[model samples]
Target chain A: MNWRGNALKFCDVAGLPALEPFVRLLAGEDVKEQLKGIAKFVVLPVAAVAVFLLLWSAAARTVVTDSMQLPSPTDTWTAGKELFAMHSAQRAEDLKVKQEKTMQAVTLLAQANSVTKQAESATGERKETLLANALVLKKKAVQAANYRPSSAPTFVDQIITSLKTVFVGFAIATLIAVPIGVLCGMSPWCNAALTPFIQIFKPVSPLAWLPLAFLIIVWAYSGTKPGENFFDKAFLISAITVSLCSLWPTLVNTTLGVASVDKDYMNVARVLKLSWSQQLFKIILPASLPLMFAGLRISLGVGWMVLIAADMLAQNPGLGKFVWDEFQNGSSQTYARIAFSVIIIGLIGLLLDRIMIFMRNLVSFGDPQAA
Target chain B: MSVAVLDRPRSKAIARPAPPDPLISMRAVCKGYGSGVTRNEVLSNINLNLRKGEFLAIVGFSGSGKTTLTKLLAGLEIPDSGEIVMDNEIIKGPSQERGIVFQNYSLLPWLTVRGNIALSVDRVFKHWSRGERRDHVEKFIEMVGLSHAVHRRPHELSGGMRQRVSLARTLAMKPNVLLLDEPLSALDALTRSVLQEEILKIWEEERQTCLLITNDVDEAILLADRIVPLNPGPNASLGPAFSVELERPRDKTALNHNETFKGLRNAVTNYLVAVRQKSRDDEALASEAPPIELPELQPRSLRVPRGRAG
Candidate 1:
């Protein structure tokens, strides 16, 4: 019974209420109701998706263009599989090349050792020539050992890059937004001061910020040569642009949350004689956390959306870049690949949203439906 | 002043000489909302004293600014005029010396029963070791008989239970004064009585200087050593103080049969009812104006008559 309750709670927190009926049924309570719940929550949604896919495939056959036709569901699936296969093949090829280089280096070193041994026994000119040959072999071995394979990023690699960029950008946004937001919420003076900037910049697009971010990052990295810089300039620009665009929701929400803490809670804080810092950490923060997390969820979502656009515009090595490149390629398979990428992007976005919801639920105190 | 003087309890006549100075005193305190013509006076020229270790209850009608009075006493609000003093120090703002149990049971919803109590206990006893703080919180939780629900959040608890947690939190603060702002008014009648007894029991044990703001007359009589009525508002003031001479461990069922309890209950109830009626009458007279006559009219149906049905 305890485990059943915990499982239901886990479902709620994970934003998977569809599984609740199964848990209840397993607990042996109201089988009929549970079945109805399962049908409504789980089976119905699956059926709807199936219907959607069928309609999409049927529509794909009728829609044609000079450049390419709309990709059918099967075409997109095949494209996705091919992309994954390409990624795996590239990885295997790279590994094989590295191994071949290592094997060559080993053979070269053995030759160098044999030459050095021969040189030790040789006389005069022959001895010098043998030593020189060993030196040449040793140099060749060194070159082979230092071999590095630099190739275009695979689909998986681009996906990883995109995830990394989004996370970093989201992190930067949270760090910057939360503190300033707290200040704005806690003090009317700060709020008044920041309101103009927030109002003006909040509606601005990530596209508008991209060039400016690129310029600033380029200037900052001017002293370091292109490949020598710690962070890739393109990556920084995209991330910074993402942070710039996504920070508003969190800032606004935090201010509202902090400013509108229940009057009763403030009274309690006063009565307790908690210090300003203590009041903030103990009373204000905890009280406002639900709203703050709500804001963060929005901010993260905005950041993810902005990051893809930034990546596309900035030509950063990410999923957005992959899509852009595929579009530019304009081959017979281009439409199918783009369709596959669209699904992947939507799925990733949904996953990110669910993760945010889970986090929001954790901080939402007793209000399970806060998000 | 005249009404208070006339309504003063006869118990004052038998007062002992050289009683200890009040632990807290409010002198000519006046508080109001708004300004100029629209100003609404919530409390006017209020004067009161709370002696150390005495349980005092202020009984008033809903919206008579009972909460405002409690807030003023708790130092959550400062009087617009006059002053509130504690031990010769002017009251300025809320402090740990004064703890309040809000009517809504203002328990931090995110925190469990132990965490709620521990928040106050930890702050008030900052010098105490972690174990000491934990034990102190546990003790207070035990005092309120909420040990079983120690890990439950306020939302998870019943209203009665939440109020109990609120009580424990305030008690754990070890405050010099406990201000209860109608803490049990929101509970059911059965829960109210049970809490009333629990409060009486705690008061007996702790003898802390406490002030309760409530509308329940019987509850005031049951818990308070002295009962003061806050007359209905837009300039509410304390009426006369009534002393309850009822014996300790006053049982709710048994108090019905006790002569002193019955007398005190009736007196407080009567006083509150009278003042409320008078205030209402005064408001009515002040706002009285000539009645406006309405034009006579009748609603006509949109449907055609039988003769014109074609």
Candidate 2:
């Protein structure tokens, strides 16, 4: 019975409450309720997805344009497979080319080394030429060692790129917002000072901020060559825009969480005579974490949504660019690939939210349902 | 039954001569909230002394600012006027010497029973080795009979269990002054009585100077050596103190027929009822007064301070 409770708790933390019914069924408790639980948690969701797919397929068949038709489920599936195949083939080709160049460079360097050893006895022009050739061979070998994939990013690569960009933006936003939020929550004076600025900036869209972000990035990178800079200008611009737009939810939520911490807890801290930092970390942070995570989940979702637009506007190399490029191409398969990307984006967003919920459950003391 | 008793007034009932040195002393302390026209006085001209190894319980009705007084004692909030001295030093803020078990059982929810107790033990006993600290924490957990729930979080525990964990945590700290703020009022009657016994046993063993704020008069008699009641007022102050002369290892069942128990219980009940009615009458008179009337002028040379609650 205890192990069954432990199993149910594990399921709850893992954001799979549906799994509890199976655990209860195995434990031989309340067969009727367990069966109902299984049906409600498992069977219903599958049925809903099936109905959604069927409707999507019917809707896809009805829509048509001069250049392309809307993609059905089968078309989207094929397009997804093709995208994976394209990525693998490109990776293979790049590897083969790099391997061939490396071998040729190694052979040339060996030849150059042997010639330089012979040139020890030789004088003037032959020795100089041998040394220069060796230098050139070593340079060639270094160049061959540097393997850069020249292929335009495949769907998988674009997905990874978008994830990376959004995370970078989310990380920057969290770092900036949490401290500010804590300051505001802890002090009425700070809250008063920051409230006006936050209110003014919060409603500004990523699209509205993109041009300003781009300008700032361009100015910062002006002294350096394009590839020599610390980060690509396009990527930085897109990320900054994402940071600007997605920061508000987390900031607002954290402030609310911190401000609303129980007075009894604060008194306990005082009675303990905990240091300022201890009170913040041990009492304030743990107490506020549930609401903070709620804010973070919202921020991540907003960041993900904003990243696509940022990528498209700045022509950053991510899924949004991929979609924009496909739209421009207007091929027979373009609509299907776009449909596949849309589903993939939605799935990724769902997964990110589930991961946040799992984390919230771990740190939270309140009911998991509240989160 | 007690308008005549109210006429006996405050300075005569329960005041005691001060011992030479006290663990805690509050002198003419006054506390209120807000400013100017909106200022609401909660406690006024309060004087109290807590001797070493004493168990004191403070009983008051809801909204009588019992919490405000406790907060002042804990040094969580400073009084508007007057000084609260502990060990001859005026307390400016909270210190480790004073630990509080709040009424709500303010256990950090994310922490398990062991973790909650360990948090305080580790902080206070920083000089102790890791094994010693863990051993100390386990000892308190056992004392509280929470050994089975050592790894359970607060949310998993019942109300009685949570309060027990809270008690364990405070006792584990080994604070010189253990301030309990209505810690048992939230529990069911059975659990409350069970805990009241547990508290008695623990206090007998440890003998830490404890101050408890509670609404239950029976609880006050059961656990405390001295019981203090707060009068109902906008400026509510300590009314009277009753010392329990009952023997140690007293039983709840046997106390029912005890003559001293009956006498003390009647006196406390009568005092509480009289003050509550008087405050209600004061409210009625104030409402009946004309709102537009000019404030009366007092003779500045002949003003006198109010008497302290005994």
Top candidate (lDDT): 1
Model 1 ranges with Cα > 4 A deviation: A105-148, B1-18, B290-310
| Position A9, candidate 1: lDDT | 85
Q: What TM-score describes the B chain of model 1?
A: 0.89
Q: Where's the lowest-lDDT run of ten residues in candidate 1 chain B?
A: B1-10
iRMS (Å) per candidate: 1.0, 1.3
Ten-residue region with minimum lDDT total, candidate 1 chain A: A362-371
Q: What DockQ does model 2 achieve?
A: 0.56
Deviation from native of the Cα of residue A323 in model 2, angstroms? 0.6
Docking class of 2: medium
Flag regions of model 2 displaced more than 4 Å: A1-3, A120-127, B1-21, B127-132, B289-310
lDDT of 1 by residue, A1-371 (tens): 69998998888887898889999999999999999999999899999999999999889988997777999999999999999999899989999998999999999999999999999999999999999999999999999999987989999999999999998888899999999999999999999999999999999999999989989998898888878977788899988998998899999999999999999999888888788999999999988888898899898889888888999999999988989999999998998999998899889989998888998888876776723
